[model samples]
Target: MKLEPFLLEILVCPQCRAPLNEADYDGHPELVCTAADCGLAYPVRDGIPVLLVDEARRPV
Candidate 1:
């Protein structure tokens, strides 16, 4: 996921209210919230963010 710098700055963890970071999955990039306390990662596909927990996949 190629999130704009401005957008990334404002993105928050839906579960933890923490900051976000970028994580790569099998060469596929995504925006993730690593609030260790939350233990969930939000994904982005085809330039669209899939923020649902059910839509997310475990890193392979």
Candidate 2:
């Protein structure tokens, strides 16, 4: 699924309030926190972004 550029531009990491960058995770689209200290990855399911910190995946 494709996230709108406008939405992506406004989305931030719930963990650190850092801007989120678009990336691919397991062949699916995801949003990754730009803060190196946080390194959280939020998944997008059915065009909806799951931005909860508890739901975010830690960087590998």
Of the candidates shown, which would achieve the greatest TM-score relative to the real structure?
A: 2
Candidate 2, residue 11: Cα displacement in angstroms equals 0.8
Put down candidate 2 lDDT per residue, 1-60, tens digits, no spaces.
Answer: 778899978999887899998889889878999998999999888878999998889999
Candidate 1 C-alpha error for residue 36, in Å: 1.6
Clashes of each: 1, 0
- lDDT minimum window of 10 residues, candidate 2: 1-10
Highest lDDT against the true fold, candidate: 2
Question: Where is model 2 more than 4 Å wrong at Cα?
Answer: none
Cα error, residue 37 of model 1, in Å, equals 1.3
